[model samples]
Target: MTGSPALSSRIAELEAELAELRAEQAREADGAMLKVLLDDIEKRHAVERRLHRAEEWLHLAEEAGRVSAYTFDFATGTLDWSPSTLALYGFPLDEQPTLGRWLAAIHPADRPAVQAIADHALQHHGDVDHRFRIVGPGGWRWIEDRGRIVRNEDGSAARLVGINIDVTELVELERRASLDGERLRLALAAGRNACWDWDLVTNQVTWDQQLGVLAGVADFGGDFDSFWALVHDEDKPRVRAALDRALATGSDYRVEFRMVREDGSIRWTFTQAKVVQDADGKPVRLVGIDSDITETKLAHLALNESRLFLVSVLGASPDCIKVIEPDGTISFMNSNGQLLMDIADFEAIRGKRWVDLWPAEAAPLLEHALSEAVAGRRSRFDAACPTAAGTPKWWDVSVAPITAEDGTVERILSISRDVTDRKDADDQLQLLNAELHHRIKNTLATVQALARATLRSHSDPAQFEAAFSSRLESLGKTYGLLRSGPQAATLSELVEAELGPFGGRSDALAIGGPEVLLSSNAAVSVGMILHELTTNASKYGALASPGGKLAVDWTIEDGNVALSWREHCGDPVAPAAPASDGGFGSKLIDRLTRQLDGKVTRVWSDDGLSLTCRFRQSAD
Candidate 1:
């Protein structure tokens, strides 16, 4: 609407003012809108920067942790893998990813279980956390996957997004640690050892089931004092001291002590412990194992007793016994053995080579014997072992192997006996036997010659028989005296033996002789002579009559033996004159006298007959 001129001017001015105001209001509204727009853009830039930083951090964490992100589309059965995931699955980067390929990358043996778990997670739309093995060009790798299933609006499975981590090193470490723990447990069980842990502050003790069994306790409480009380009275102070020292010095503790069980039986325990300390270096815990060592301790005691018994037996042995090591060194020798070896001090010969103790000539033989013994064969040899004083002696040495429990040759046991005297005696006996054989052969020949001559001197068959019988009897008596004596005989014994058959009456026969032993040869000759004289006397000289008397005497003069024979109070005897057939008795007397290297003279007197013979003494 238009106004009057004066009114219209004012109205126009007011309208102008109102229009300016409106314009100003409009300008204010536009500036407020621009401010709001600028604030929104800055806020968006800040959010974008924060998102970028978060992404960078996440990528850094994934790389540092060897983790990879992956996604699987359930509808298309498609799989997507990060670079790291592809490397883990041994898939080339250029290769297309698929669910089938991912399943194929799983270890054949683990594929079924992995697929079932993944299918369960997909159907349930649940989260997944699983560990599985993947086979690749690099052998095998362990993977830890954690993800959640994404669902569509209708709750059906859509896809799976997850992070895969290469946990091969961790898995290997866990496997090795588990194996080591199993091995340790097995070893402890085999050794009859028990594990224990102690809390130093509370003085509380914890023991495994094995420890309770060892203590004969059905249910052992964690009372430290009860265990301490189980220690033997004699070992309590020692055990306490050891623990104190270990705790004070932060050192390992090891001790062997006797423990008293609930049944009052004693057991040997070997404990090894490590002290665990806190940051302040104060001991807080003690971890250790206790091994039952009663059997081992008893065995050691038995071994010591056996060793003592062996030493006693060796010391008392009569033979020289030596124990040589496998290297031929003399390991042990008893007192008796040392004495036999003429060594006053055992230490002088100890640790010395066994072969070096023998003379050079015997060393090789001893070495060979030792070798044979070491090879499981017993060897025996006789050697001349010279003493330290240079006295030669013979020894019969036997070498035998001493074996260990494993049938390995541990040492050679050598036993020696002295046989020097026995050897000498044997040699002497051999010589005497040879001489006796020669003497017996010569005697037989002489007897044969006498028998033939005796037969030749006789005429009548009956007379030849009687005369040969008497002569043979005389020869037999001579041999008997020589055979019964030891290399020699006394003349008086021969006379007594020859006259024993005639008469044993002292009044009828008189024999006198000095104590003279005759040589083996001379004794035979003298026996024959005595036989002849006694026979002649008994037949016709003195012994023929009841009142006849015979006297025989022998004397030693200047190393010569003189013997005389006289007959009396009997029918008078006369010497037979030389004839073609002289009596065999006479011939025997003459031959025997010549054999003695002596002379014989005969005198036929009125009262009696007398004969005298002289010879050099030849008895040894």
Candidate 2:
């Protein structure tokens, strides 16, 4: 349908205008869409930057704290680990994450329990907190794991996410601390000491279990005053003073005191304490240890008494007793020893070497003896000790080593005795014994010779018996004279003793001689000669007649002795008989003269008989 021209033109213009407005609206909408897209892109970039920063912070936190994050999927049996988690497990990034691999990383000893714990947490959808060890390339590492389980829709366990922390250093420190505590306890037990702590502000005391045992109490109340009251009355003031001094000077306290036990018995205790000071240097607490020392104290006292007794005994000894140090110094010498050395002061020789005390000639021997004794051997010797007075004295010395408990030589002990008098007496006895032996032998030989002669001279048994008895009686008298004197007999004494039995009258016999001491040999020989001569005169020579007379005289000259025997007023005598064919009396005179190393002469005359003999005057 054709409309009017004016209406047609307006409709056309309206359509064109509508077309232009629609194009403008479409351009505006496209520009708005571009603005929204740019805003979204900027917001995403900001979020990316923040995410990068957060990831870096988390990595730094994990490394600093030694922590690693892990996730486990139960259904898939898979494990996921962060970079730090892999490093903690000693696994490289290229290694695949799996439950088996994670379980393999756990220490063999703890694997079974760790797996069980993880399994229980997964099944029960429970939280997990466990500490365990894991094997790594470096070594074993302790791990503390904490995680929360995620459940599925059916309320069953699904997954686990957790953090793992390396606690190796912490575990090692804890273990060391535990060992130190145990060592301290053992030390206290071994020492039999108790540890105590006292607080000054609260006046409260704390004691270890050992202290309670020492106090003889099961439940010890930590009361300071009560513990002080247990101290002995004599020791209380000392203990209090020590504590006060320690507190005032902020120093360590040490004291030894006595305490009364529950049984009312006394016990010695050694206590030491350190004052714990505050910031202002005021004492706040005291820490100390106490030990029982009753046995030690008693032993020391007993040792002192024993030493005193030993000194007393040594001083009372009569022998020359000395104690020498190992170095040869004279450590101790009794009074007798000092007197033996002629030293008035013991200090003069106290520190002197033992060898120096003796003469130089005996020093070597003394040194050898000391060395032997120090080597733990006993030594003995006889030595001539020159005293301080310069007199040589003989001594029998003995040295013995004194040993300590450890089998080492501690000192040398020496004892000396004077033997001079004993030695002199022994020498005298020896001389006398030899003289007696010689005299006995000569007497026996003479008796034998006399018996033989008597047998030959007498044919009748009765006559022979009387003659032998008379000779034996004369021999017995001579022997008695020899025995009466110590060294020798006087010539006059011997003559009187032998002749007194026959006829001691001056009218019948005359005896004259100078005073002379005859040797033992000479005395015996002279006595026998006189006895024979007297018997002969009495029998047949001169004394047999009433008017008979006998003369006997002796003289000494130039160490020679001359003796004469004369008889007169008797029967006429015959020529002197040869000694070989002489009777027993004549043979005896010849033999006795020969023994005397002299000569005998017999002259026969009508008036009487005369005899002369000469010998050395061994007679003193």
Candidate 3:
């Protein structure tokens, strides 16, 4: 407007033209906006129609599904059950629901358990999906209840929402299926399984294909009389009676009878039947199974016969035969064994420890033999084992290991034979032989000692023979005395035998002593000593001269035999004193005294030679 009037006037017309175009554009935009708004309304209406249809379908599904929805308000402590829930509990649509009425509908037997489960879920904010029985207007029904805890922002349970479903039909189907399964299992357990069905009202029979094939009749008759014809004539009455009892009581029928097969052979069979009843408890049908038990029956009979044979064989054995368990306990003992062990009743000892029956002192021996057998080895022992009645007897026992299938020792068989007589005879024989051996050996030893002494004293062979023969004669006499008793000679006997040759014939010999006995071995030692002294006296001292005298005396001192031997020469001066360690006579006397376990002391005086010896008692 300030630039020029003509420019201002053109600008006004352009402004009006721009205003008209903007206004027309606004009108077009308004119409398009209205169209968009209408389109939005149509889409919303379509979604709403789908949603409403879905809700209606849901309600119908809830009714048909036998399910009811429920919600419990935690704060208000109010429970709301949907219309379907009321119908499930047999309540009218307008019935007011109450907690007490809901509780009363639960079956008495299931109330405590259901309440416990509900309480646990509530305390732990847990989900619940379980089934229980309830008595409703529709009668006893099974209910499947499920619930989820609705949590607030803080995760606290604000409400419990769940559904209840009537599951009575499902429960009944499960129970019937379980019963049928049990019947099938029983049929399978029966040997040579076959099935049959009989209709009581029509008296008609139906056989499974397996039964017909087994009966040798693919086109088997479908009547009660045809089924009865299969049973043996002798068993017909008993089987009919069983069937009658089952029908009368509506119970099961079981009987074992004989049936003639197509091969014209009679075999045993076990037949069992279940009676089916109608709603009024009337027997309507009989379902049964037949199992052939011929093989089993024959096996049992054979086993019994075998057992009798084994018992007879065992009874015939005289020896004590015992069967021991792997644990070293008595399992069985044969009749003869029971008598031997003094057991009146085998039952009294059954399961008793086998080792305990033996004496405690013999436990070590018995246990050692048992271990050997347990290690799969055979063992034997001969010992004096007494019976229960305390009768002493010796036995020769053999233990053999009995192995099982796995080759481990499972049992032990012990056989004991009485050996008392043999043992006694052996012991007596041993004692006699010992006595004979001692006598022979003693004689030989004495001969050797005499020969050695004589050779030591005499250098000439003839002189040695003369001296040795004389000593041998004295030894022979000593043996004669020993033979008079038990390989032993009295002290007096030994002394007299030796001195009699030198001084017994004359009054010059003197002897004094109490009765003292010496063993055969000790007698030999003392005899040698006496013989040496006599020889020495006869050669040089007393027996060499007429007036020489000899005196020998023995006494017990300190539980030992002490012997004193003295010689008188009848000369003023001592007969030249015998060399201490020189002559054979002196050495022989010293050695023999030591052999007697005695010490010797000698003194030479004006009289002659004096000697003393002490020897202990001995046994040959």
Tens-digit lDDT string for candidate 1 (115-192): 998888766767899999999667898999999787899988787889998899999999999999888878887889
Pairs of residues clashing in candidate 2: none
Q: Which stretches of candidate 1 lie over 4 Å from their true place?
A: 1-49, 70-125, 134-141, 148-162, 187-233, 250-252, 259-269, 273-294, 312-329, 335-345, 353-620
lDDT (Cα, tens digit) per residue for candidate 2, span 100-199: 8788889999999999997787667688899999987689999999998877899877778788999999999999999998898888878879999999
- Candidate with the larger TM-score of 2 and 3: 2
- Between candidates 1 and 3, the one scoring higher on lDDT is 1
Clashing pairs in 1: none
TM-score of each: 0.46, 0.49, 0.39
lDDT of 3 by residue, 407-490 (tens): 998899998887877888897578447535644554564466445545655789998777777767876676566443457778
For residue 275, model 2's alpha carbon misses the true position, in angstroms, by: 4.1
lDDT for 182 in candidate 3 is 73
Give Cα distance to truth, residue 319, candidate 1, Å: 7.9
Worst 10 residues of 2 by lDDT: 572-581
